[model samples]
Target: MHEIPVPPAEATAAVPRLQRLYEHRHPALSPVLAWGTDQSGVWVAVEPNEGTPLGSILSRGPLTPPAAAAIGAAVLSGVAALHEAGIALGGFGATAVRVTTNGDIRLAGHPAAAVRAAPSQSDLRADVRSCGMAVCAAFGVDPAGAPAPPNISPGLVVTMRSMASGAMGPSADRAQAALREMAAALLSPDREMAAQSELATRAGGRELPPITPFLPEGTVAPKPTAPTPAPYIAPTPRQETPVRSPVSYDAPDRPLQTYPSMPAITFPPTPVPAPAPPPPAPAAPATPAPSVPTWSDAPPRPSAPVEPEARATNPPAPPTWTPMEAPLPAPAEPSKAAEPEAPKPAPTFETAAPASPFATFPPAAPPPAEAPAPSAPPAQQTWTPVEAPVWKPGETVPAEPLGTGVAVVETPPKAPTPAPIPRAPIAAPARRPSVARPPSRRGPLSERPPWLLPAAVAVAIVILLGIFGVIVLANRGGGQVTGGVHTTPTARASTSPAASSPSPSATTKGPLAVPNFGPTSADPISKVQICTTASPCNIPGGSPENGTACDLSSCKIEVAIYFSSVQKSAQVSYTIKFFDRCTGQTTDLPGPSASTPASGYIVSIPTDHWTVSIPNGVKSGAIVAVASKPAVARSEPLLLGADSCA
Candidate 1:
């Protein structure tokens, strides 16, 4: 085992990846087992193998084409499997290929190094190149530096080169398949020849069709067929031949024919024919033809081309001096000349593209809206200058300036009032001695000393105690223990239930200490009927379904009740009833209103399944089903929750 130390964070991240890739165990690929990490590095346990690397194998001797292909095929198989699982082995090379003692090529590499969370097309193609390099190395060529392996099938060489050079498709699936097929074909030349010979014998022998190499599955090239098999004829009885083991092919005896190699060729895809152009719908307004640009120098209302005679009769005015005229809005007469509208044609396939159901014509505005046309030439109107009249001071023009902020004229000063005669000094009344009054303590309690509040509280408590004592003496005596020493009862201690409590039928509010009615309250049995028809909702055999909730939009409750087979013949009656907490009286619930949009009903569904709804505004109530006779068996009542739609 070799150890590669990575950052603790990187190792932590790669643990999951290595652990996942560990499941791909193949004789063609060594597995990596993660033993986890430590302060030193991430630990990976790999299978120990005696086989030498591809580089070592090449160092020993060059391998034959079949040998190279066999190794390449095995490695490609492992690569393809990993690729399918979304794992790509980066840094793949000759060192990654291990030749076992039994002559198997297993791929070996640091899977951690190739742990990419987001493998992409480039990564896959790089894997394909790695396979090609393995092939090159097996053929005794330096994969890192070689363009193509020497002395292998030229066709095979080209395939390998294309992959290594990134000329193949983005994925390795096709290349992987091609390598497997070639390896198989090369491994059994004898079987192939035997099959071909038998085929040839079966052929009538007019001439055998040229054999095209098998392409990858789904490749669509030209299809070719063989000559028809020998025609059926009356024949003698035949005996079955004995089975025989395949013989190992000898190289020298037949010097296997220089069989042409099959290259994987994926033909170009067939093109889809374009749909026919649409027919012009007559409803399509005759807008300016597309050949003419909308914004052109040519006038919208073009002048007819002047004839030579007309030009000679009236020498044309300077074209540049002619003032441009804005298009005038046509006068609206009651439209007596309006053409009869054409019937719209039914849209056909040809017109579907151009005819839009949403298309609408602009609303018609009458000629009264020709304000722009009249005002367009208003800027051209000529106005004559007029003289202004002069004004004399104190006449038409006032003395003051135009602005209000300024006082251009002065006003006469007002006469001062005569100084008031000096009045005799009025003497202030003699001050009387203020009577010394004690301060009244009228102030907020906050202003007083803090001890005052505590004292007042103590007094109030003493007064309450005296009142309680007086009441005890005046009426029944206090039930105090003789010792006057009593321990306070803790909440956790048990208490005796009331001597008498009303049964559920009593419906009395206070009689039964109603089991604490809030969350920590005991579970109350609120029965809901599981029936279809009110008359037989819980009937032993009726297949009535609970109608949908009265208002499913707000709240809904679905329920199902099952009864014993023995009770199938019985009929049941159901009604809703509510316990009015405020009224302290139980009231039979009224049927859901027809005016209510919801179809709220409490009934058994399909004989056994039942549903009961409690929509908003429906009184929180108990839905009861009374059996016609004594029922042999009955389903436990299901509770319809208040807060939710079930």
Candidate 2:
């Protein structure tokens, strides 16, 4: 495996190299396990480095001198191993090296070493020189012969210059061993601590300066003077909560809980005074006595309140009352003259005896009043005789008498007028026979000739014929009315003599009237093409192109309609259907019908493209498109390809 640092412009070329490297492996090279292309482009799976990137360390203005020496030693060690294996890295740099927290180096970035290619002299030299560059970079110095910083030891500086110049000898083992010695010397415990402290200080003083002892050993620190006492402030008293006592069921051996003392509460010695008694109720009022209903002639009296009578020591008895009844007339003495009529009793009231039948008036009002006088009976009806009708010499008299003349003529009683009675029909008297009368003479104007009827009939016929002609001519003048469309008559551009005179054959069809409109043409949809591909159906290689056939399990179907001209910007809707010839069934395309108000050219639809699945069947089917707007129009159906069953 290898790391190919392809430049931004040359990224496409790295894929081939990555593929080649996956075929071989080497210790100094990280391995690529797999590589593939996705929608996001090329990707490679390589072993991940579990170390701190050397580049990250160097990015922060280089490492300490000792750390630079350690990195240099590890890089050389890896290169020496490569040299022993007779292979060299294609390139090496800060990016190609990684250092673990434990200070071990990992080598990478050789696409060539991944394939185990033989190393060239120049390649070997380049690896060693790259190692030197890494060392110089770690020391924060230029690898182009610039003087090393004064802090780096002279021996380590010489080693950096030799490796950078590619003069470190044929084998890196010698340089690697010398670098180990320099790193150990520079990385001593005391020096390392000093370097870290210096670095931390340069990065913003995270390390504290050495602290001085509180006092010198021979002398005593002056006894800390007692801090001057702050002015006295009284502390606030805290409220103490009382502890709750334990329940009686607690273990007998347990100690009893004690509570804080509470202040005493005092109560008055005397009991509170009793509430005052309620006030007495007021006396009830006396009730008015009930009054009797009187006749209309009687005057109404004002009412007065009656005082209740004092109760007696003994229980009082209920008083008796007399119902005022009409007095009966005395009966006539018996025919024997022996029995006498019983006397009538007079009416009485609870308060007093009444002298008349109306005596029981309201006790609260006036006393009894006299009864009204009785009205006289209606006078009887009297009869006045009606005179008999005088008889004529030839008049006939009925055998029945005129309904008991006496009763019929009786005077009506003195009451409302009665309804009039319907009179019965009476027979007329017979009359003598009379002589025949002469006929009246006719006038000259009233006289009619025998030919009058036929002449009248002929005139009526002539009037009817004129009306029929007018109706026929009016109908012919209007333009023909076909399907609901209305076509107004258009004036001809120029009328030729032939157009002016109607043809003899036209006369046979109907009464010849002036023509009202010009000839018309067909519907707007002139061409329709349906196919499986999204491309124009007229184009070559489009699946089941116009007039072709289709045979597939599933396919995207698009429709293209062409029109030569439009009557208006009419809203047009399209529906596609599949006709299954095998089952004689027609199914609508499974999507919303497409509609558009645009016209005058090809209009493709559905904004969302759709596809249809052809069900397995015995044989052929047909696809049809119907435009249902502006005007109903249909396309010639196209057949599915040769029958699958066949």
Candidate 3:
């Protein structure tokens, strides 16, 4: 056999153990020889003969009768051997049997032992059923392949089929019966017993080895032959009898009998035949043609009596009966036959009255006139006369003339113009006494009086002024003043009180000392700022002549005030001005006293040492020192008296 590749690690490990077990159990059979794990866990065994499996042979179609019977007998024998060894060939199928070239057959890869070891009974029976299937498949028949022999009941065949189909219950009896039936059929008289015997001999020693496991017990070989003969023959036309008035036939001597019910035969009476001398018996009773078994001319005789010898010699004939043909009636025309009449339409009613009831009412009178006549205009007007006029006290009216039979009423004529009512001119109507209005009770004014705001402002100003005056008075004596003060009076007062106190003040005095200032050095000073808030007299380089009152405090130096020396090509002059804090004015003490034209200042003092003081009254603000570099100093003023400093 060609070598199959070694399987994966797990399969490789399991193969040796399985091989050992298989070899141990099936010593008579060829060793597994070699095996390889397939994708499924099942091992593929390589045997010496390189033959196709029985399944493949059968799959090609029905086998020749000889080969089929031979293979079936061999398979049954193999299964019977396995059953004897208590090994169930689980998963058995035609595929499990292999046919060698020599025509010998062997069962391969029996699974019965494994199935028996399974925990479930269902699984065990499943294995047996599978073996039964293999037998059925090998025989090219169903699990119920043929009607079982008489000794094997039909119920047993049904049970076997059910088992093969995975129905409930153990099928040991069923499978045994089925196997026996197959074996019997194959070995029956009609079969070639010689061929089967030869095949069996060829396959005898080749049966599956006695493995460790097996199917369930009660594995019996099929009976040598059915214990009883079939009572009835298969029905056929030739076996039927001619009709002779309904009658029954009985086999008195046989163990079983069947009688067919026959219909009366009514033959048209034959013309009476003339009597003739008896004829000698014929050599053999003429056999009737299968189609025309009964003839009218045949002489009627009494039923034939059975002879003991004939009964013992011949097999019983199967009963049959002629089928009667009934004639069909003719069809009738549907149109000639009476049909149910169509239902009549329901009746409708009409009223005797006119169709429309409202047609007779008289037409409505023409719509009433919408507007009244215009003749009586006043009447048409909706307004009515006022009932009475208001009267004046003394005015008189003229009377109407005595009516001409018409009663006329007259108003009195104005009293003769009373001579210009000379009396003191009628005082103009006493001015209606001016009605006195009670003083208005409206609430206080809604908006604040304008004067009130000014008053409040004045009061606030006064309060602020008082506070300011007190602050000034208190600060005059240096009572912890905050924020720089510019007035000289305040400064002097603050200083004088501290100086004159009986106890020497702890305050430091003299040329004011600047703290936290040092010359720049290689280590790089972090920052250079002088604290001059406490002292106003000290300037880094300012001469005392500049003025003791010069207000030199809190000054910063301009390191490069004159840049000309650094720039050798030009002559320039720079002036720095200092202002007095107490005077609110500025004075240039030393710088640019006059424009001395030069390229630069060359002196030992580091230019960074030059300091400009901030004056006392100059808003107590910071002093800004600047460095100026010019191309040249002006030889003459471009505009006379135009301060170059400005």
The local distance difference test score of each candidate is 0.45, 0.51, 0.38
By lDDT, is 1 or 2 better? 2
CA error at residue 521 for candidate 3, angstroms? 99
Location of the lowest summed lDDT over 10 successive residues in candidate 1? 593-602
TM-scores of the models, in the order given: 0.27, 0.25, 0.22
Better of 1 and 3 by lDDT: 1
Evaluate model 3: give its lDDT.
Answer: 0.38
* lDDT digits (tens) for residues 328-360 of candidate 2: 223333353444433324445465343233224
Report the number of the highest-lDDT candidate. Answer: 2
Question: Compared with the true structure, what per-residue lDDT tens digits does model 3 show for residues 216-288?
Answer: 1322222233357769887666766877654357434554345566899898988988999865633322432
**CA deviation > 4 Å runs, candidate 1:** 114-117, 140-152, 189-646
Compute the lDDT of residue 189 as modeled in candidate 3: 44
List candidate 2 segments past 4 Å from native: 1-46, 50-52, 101-103, 187-646
